[model samples]
Target: MESARIPFTERYHATQHGGIARAANSSVTCKTAAGRTATPCAAVQQGGAGANGHYRMAYIDVDSDARTANSSSATLRIPAGSRVSYARLYWGGSLRGSGQKAAKDNGRVLLAEPGGRYRQVRADTMTGHRPHSATEGFQASAEVTELVRNSGGGAYTVAQINMATGHSTAGVWGGWTLVAAYENKKQPLRRIALWDGFQSLGADRRELSVRLPGLRIPANSHGLAGVVAYDGDRGHGNDTLTVRAGQHRAHTVRDTANPANDVMNSTVTDLGRPTMRWPAYRNTLGFDSDVFDITPALRSGGDRLTFRFTTTRNPGYLLGALFVQTDTRR
Candidate 1:
C-alpha cells in the first residue's frame, strides 16, 4: 500500500482528535496462555485514545535505574483476516518540559510472528528517528526521538499500526505502533454522542460493576477515587506524572507512591510489582468551584481519565485511568 500522504497539521489534528478505533480485530491468531494458537477476544489498545484515533502519549520511566527500567518491546493486535502490509514504530528522546528540549532520533519498525515472540526484527537499525509529533499524527513523516527527548525524559517510542484495509488479519504483528490513520469521512461534533459505555475485563477471573452518575456536572460534588496501573520496564516507581485541575493543587504520584502501603514497612525494594495494590478509598467527596473550570474537569467523562505511563520500560506499560462522571441532566 502506498504511504498515506497526510499533511503534518492534518495528522496532528487527527491524532489528537480521533482516538484509536480498535487496536486489533478478533480474527488475528495469538498463542493463548495454555499454549494453543487462539484468537484474541478483543483488539487491545494499551494507551487511551485521543480526540480522533490518535492515542494519548505514553512513556518509559527510565528515572533512576537504567538497566532493568528500560523497555524492550510492545505488542499490537491485528484482526485474523486483515493483512498487515506495512508497519513502523516511532521513537524520540528529546527534552521539552518546563522549558527543556532534548535531542531526536529516527526509530524503525521490527516485525514479529506468532510463537516467535517480539524479538528484535532487526539488530543493525539505527535509533535516531523523530516520533510523529502530536501535530504530525499517524504518518511516519516525523521522527520518534524528538518526542522523547522533547518530553524532558529519557528515550521513548510511539507505536502505530497501519490498517488501510479494515478487514481482520491472520496473525497480529507485534511491535507495530498502530496509529490513527483517518476517518472514511469527517465526523461532525453534533454527531458525537457522549455517553457511558461498558468495558469488559475478561482476564484476571474477575468482574467489576461500574457506575456512571451521568454526563452533566453537579453543583455539589465530593471526593474522587480512581485506579492506576503500569506497564513496561522494572520497578514500581516508574509510573509518575503531574496531574492538575484548575486552581486545585497539582499532585504527582508514582505507581508505587500510594500511601496505603507503608514504604517503611514493606521489605520489597521494587515498587512496581504485578500484585502491588494501592489503597484507594476516600472519605468525603466535594468539588470546589475551581475544580469545575480546569482541564481535568472539562475532560471529565465516565471512562476517560488522563493516564501517563512508559511504553518503553516494559513495552506494555500503557497506563489506564477511569474517572466517574455525574450528569446534571436529572
Candidate 2:
C-alpha cells in the first residue's frame, strides 16, 4: 500500500546496506565485520573460488551482538539545529532464510539510536510481501520519528529484521532504510516526498511511475531522487529511472555509482559514493538503495513531477521505495 504524504515542506536523508555474507552457522559469525573493522562485503564475495573460477554471493545477519537476534548499523547524517519532521524505518529481504512466520513478524523490529540500546518498533500500516520464490521479496516499515528525533544523527542500529542468512539462486539478501525528513530554516524551500510499495518489474510490470502534483519550481532548479529496489544485477542494461517536471522533457537520472542505463544495479550509496554501514558492500548482489541528483532535468520547471522506473530484464526486480526532494518556490 502507498503511504500518506507528509506536508511536502521537509528535506530528507537516509542510510542502508546490502546484508552480509554469513560465514558460519551462527548469526554471530556474520557480524565479525561490524563497528571496528571496515569490512567491505567485497572481501567475502564467495565461500571460496572454485575450478570454474566463479564465486557465490550470499547474505547473513549483521547485528553487533550474536547473543541477540539480528542487527545492522548505518550512519544518518542530519545537519545541526534541524528538527526531525518525520522518520521511517524500512526492512526487507528474501524470505527463504528469514525463518518461520516472517510475514507475521515483519511488522515489528528492534531499533537502537546512536549511543542507545535496542527497543521494539512496530509498523503503523502496510507491508509489501511475497512468498519465497525465484524473485526478490517483501518489505516492512515503521515510523521512527520520535526515536530518531531524540537520538539525532549518527550510527543507528536495527535488529530483528527477519532477513535470511546464507545464499540461493535468488540470493540471500536483506537490508534496512531509515528515511528522515527535517525542518531546517537555514535550508532552501523544497518539495520532499517519499513513495513506497512492493512491486515487481519483470514479467508482470515493466514500469512504475510516482507523481507529485501542484508544485512551484524555479528555472534551472536542482534536487535529488532515490530508490530502494531488489534483485537487480550489476551491468544489466535497459533498466532506468527517469524524472520529468510537468510537460518538460524527461531526463534519465544517474550518478557515478549508478549508470544511466542500469539504475537498479545492486549497490548502496549517496549520490554514487559508498555509505558507512556494517557489512558494507560495493556490490549488494541483488539489492539496491541508491540516490541520484535530478538538477539538470528540473532546469525547466513545472507544476508536476513524475518519476518513471523501468526495468526490462529477466528474474525481475522488487521496488520498496522512492524519495524525492526538489527545489521549489516559496
Best by lDDT: 2
Candidate 1: where are CA atoms >4 Å away? 1-11, 14-18, 21-176, 181-232, 236-238, 245-330
Per residue, candidate 2 scores C-alpha lDDT tens digits across 1-330 of 422121122223322111101000111122223233333434433321111001232334565576656666778888788777777777776665324334567777778888898898987766777764554356777777898889878887777766565434455566778887777777777777777767777776788777777778788887877677766766657898889998989998888878898877777788887777775656666667877778888888888888888877866678877777777765
Query: For residues 1-330, what per-residue lDDT tens digits would candidate 1 score against the true structure?
Result: 111121111112111111111111111111221122321212212111111111112222212334222222222323332222222233222122112222221222322232232223221223222133211111122222222222221112222222111111111111222221222223211111111111112122122222222133332322222231211111222323333333334434333323211111111111222211111101000000000112334333322223221221222221112222222222
Per-candidate RMSD vs. true structure? 19.4, 7.7
lDDT of each prediction vs. the true structure? 0.21, 0.65
TM-score list, all predictions:
0.24, 0.81
Model 2, CA-based lDDT: 0.65
Model 2 residue 270 lDDT score: 83
Lowest summed lDDT across 10 adjacent residues in model 1 is found at 282-291
Clashing pairs in 2: 63-71
Relative to the unseen true structure, what is the C-alpha lDDT of residue 14 in candidate 1, on a scale of 0 to 100? 19
Kindly report which residue stretches of model 2 are placed more than 4 angstroms away from their true locations once superposed.
1-64, 97-102
